[model samples]
Target: MRFELARLFLLERKQSDAFERRAADGSKLNREQWLREVFSQEIDFIHRKSERRFVPDQSRPKGEQRIVARIGRKTLSHENDPNDHLKEITREQWRACLVIIDPTSHDDGQKVAIETSSIVGSGFGNFESLITTINGHSPPEPFVIELHSITDQTTFWEYVDRHKGKITSIALEVVMPNMFGGSSSFEEDAKQLRDKEKARKIKETIENEDGLEPETERMRDAVSYATRGGGKVKAKAKGATPYDSTRDKKYIEADVDSENRDINQKTEAAIEAFNKDENEAVVEKEV
Candidate 1:
């Protein structure tokens, strides 16, 4: 039972399409309201267009993490498609109470204590992909929404501003590289450096320079341990639209495994009842 906040922005893929299209009031239709409406579609839409669900079902430089919604295949059968979890919708807002799980992690049992958020799960794209299938093509205009974990991220930029130069260590999520380094430095060389200088160097190396010229890469989040004047004053390193410190908050946690959060037994019972009723009606008609 986790909650998240997200906002959607629409982008028109075709400038020509934008020129030809307008809403009822003649305002340019660029808010991706159409995509929003798609998510609000009837529950049956899930089954009608369900397919091999992907983490980000759209726009990837490489491949996506395959989201297994069932025991063996891409989607569940004799049960509900988990994508039907859209709970409420309005012109300005929508809510989805999704049940997302990582089967492998739970099975491994280091302790099944993490809650997989929709932002880091197939919940983002499962329904979106189905809508595309129903439409027979991709939406000319698509929407992008952002979600950040507020848990473990109690401190905001305001705190950082107050502390300023006191920042002891800042851990960042290295987002995109201008050019791929054959040997990338994923983590800091914590063994060699000393004091506050270590933290500064870790951040500076990625953002300031490679050797001579500086091609600063975009860091997704920065997690700082603490800021100390002399003592070990600890602060946590978080994200840009930053993710929280919890293990479940990271996308990599579920990059290899996936599961549906839907109540299988409840759905199965409903399906059974429907089938029984249908069979009875057919028998009466035959008689």
Candidate 2:
């Protein structure tokens, strides 16, 4: 008897690669023939030497495919892998190749999983890139979640190249609430609390009864103060300095981009503040 098997990724997210497929008529490509035809490029993995067959004599619901793969194994090389001479093997595994093209951004990687690692230890193959390629969708550039300081120069350039044409302008801000460690966004709860408190304080400080300035101006003023550094300005609206020698550090070495671009007023203020010592250390960065 053949084994009935699958690893359900129907609840998987629709990230850059993990998406669904559709027919030319804007319908679900759920039929065996349709799926086989749609996943032609994926099934054609050079090393996998895989063949897919449609089993119609199964007692299953509609849109459920009885796609079987008789895949040939090959030794795959992985860098810095602890295992030596990696190899794979598989039987004629029967799985429901779930290609749900329900016509929405929300989709599961069921088909992607079925094509890749549905039955194998490391997965049969990665159909994500193939999907992107076939659909003319380019892979997203890596979104770096790193410390404002201690950035790798070589890696930074690589990222810059990836980011070109995607962004029109780039602005740097002094990262706030130095606290760290948490899930979801790796942003700490305490940091979030601190940010909330900071926002509250800014609202209180900026919205004086004398003449209420625009909320945007107040926020920008506070950001300029925090990023530019704290020094008692003659004016009140300009004195949203949250960070000072009493609060955090009096100052920090500002990273200045070498690119020839117009710096906004906030940036200009920050630069002016940082240049008090004239010879104040500045890092030349362009990204």
Candidate 3:
């Protein structure tokens, strides 16, 4: 049996409306600008850059790589039509999820998988339950779920009911493998060069600068002094108010002079004690 795949696109309804309005007005905003400025901020838009890839199939070799160019074309005139504006916005493919259901296994209950860009094969029972769960929780706005192989509405509803409430646990599966090489190497090399250049510039500035080292040394010394004994060195001026002694320059000078006098007295006393000890030792030796 030939298997058919269905594509579902998720869009932001409010953002799409605003975009349509802008398009109708012939505003200068482009697709990328609309996405970045308006769509990205909306809760349903799933803010991220859309990735383009080449899918490998029977027509293409497994190892073959193709670079999918970014969508750069301007919006077409037909896209501005009221009926077609929604389709144009959806074609941007910013956010989307996939639904896969097996129609032949209706007796055993159809198997269903809801897949998104980050998550895939999240099993769900029944289409109603899936819709309920998604909408009840955090629903992506303006979503379309397309089912392939099941052409009739009766078959679709039957499959949805068969798989209801029978969610299965399965490991994450990779739907597509990226085989392209060297696409990201340029960015990586450029980043490395920029980092190296930044480091070199910083090193050169440090080496060539004159006053930075001395200034840093002075700051270190000041910190050490403050931590050791500077906190106790309060200078007070004569005739200064007790509460405002710190703000008085004369009080500060007087306090400094007092501290210096105390240090000098201590030094003189130490010297005198040493001299007396030496004289006593000489007299004892002579005796």
Candidate 4:
């Protein structure tokens, strides 16, 4: 009755002859739209009727809109634990098919043309058999891979690399951020401001008076200490490897306390100074 079962019959079992018989009996033109209609009906039914069954079963709240196969929560059932049920229906078994519902603009009367070719290029259609072959009993996990931006390839690789071994279904969806007001100026100005802010931070940190100052007061002290015999104290303390000494020019001691009260006081002061400097550094960045 479900699309998944129909698909399983058609693809996995190769029952085209049987499919034609069922299609005629069901009064459907062809199997494809019939399958989609069945799937839509099932989704609607589950949404309206399955709520009570799902309430206690699925403990966690789902996103506002989500593909049930990939991100939906599961509940403990009479048959098995939640984990076992989820393991039975994992993303590793099938791929996903996604469609983006972009928000339309009433002001400019313009729709952003998202390049779907790249998504198609990413082997989206390769999962047609998988999607068709799914059974409702154990639907393969569906990943709604939404491209928030066409220019950003990082997100694409992240999804691919992260789920290379586990992905069964890949549904590509894309949506541009909804624009507000009758102006493109806000978006353009925001971009320019971000670029300018980045440049300002880079220039100030590199070529300004603050750039000449030590990053932290403790760092200054550490530099001074290194220049004096204090560097040898840090260099020789417990766990002082040549590599560690060369890089940090400081000691690493697990169980050793300060050798004297004077050293202890300086270390305490240095730590306090370092913490103060760290906070001030963050505050400066915010300003």
**Candidate that would win on TM-score:** 1
What C-alpha lDDT do the candidate models reach, one value each? 0.28, 0.28, 0.24, 0.25
Which residue runs of candidate 2 sit more than 4 Å off their true CA positions? 1-37, 40-42, 47-60, 63-121, 132-287
lDDT of 4 by residue, 106-158 (tens): 22111111111222222122222223223332332121111111122233334
**Where does candidate 3 have its weakest 10-residue lDDT segment?**
170-179
Summing lDDT over every window of 10 consecutive residues in candidate 2, give the lowest-scoring window: 141-150
RMSD to the hidden true structure, all candidates: 21.5, 24.1, 39.5, 25.3
* Per-residue lDDT over 52-159 for candidate 2, one digit per residue giving the tens place of the 0 to 100 score: 332222222344342322333333443442364544433332432222111111111121112223443222233322233334423321111111111122322233
**Model 4 residue pairs with clashes:** 57-75, 94-168, 94-169, 95-168, 95-169, 96-169, 96-170, 98-171
Candidate 2 lDDT (Cα, 0 to 1): 0.28
Candidate 2 is scored at a TM of 0.19
TM-scores of all candidate predictions against the true structure: 0.28, 0.19, 0.14, 0.16
Per-residue lDDT tens digits for candidate 1, residues 120-185, read 244434433443454443334332221222222334344445544443443442211111111223
- The model with the greater TM-score, 1 or 2, is 1
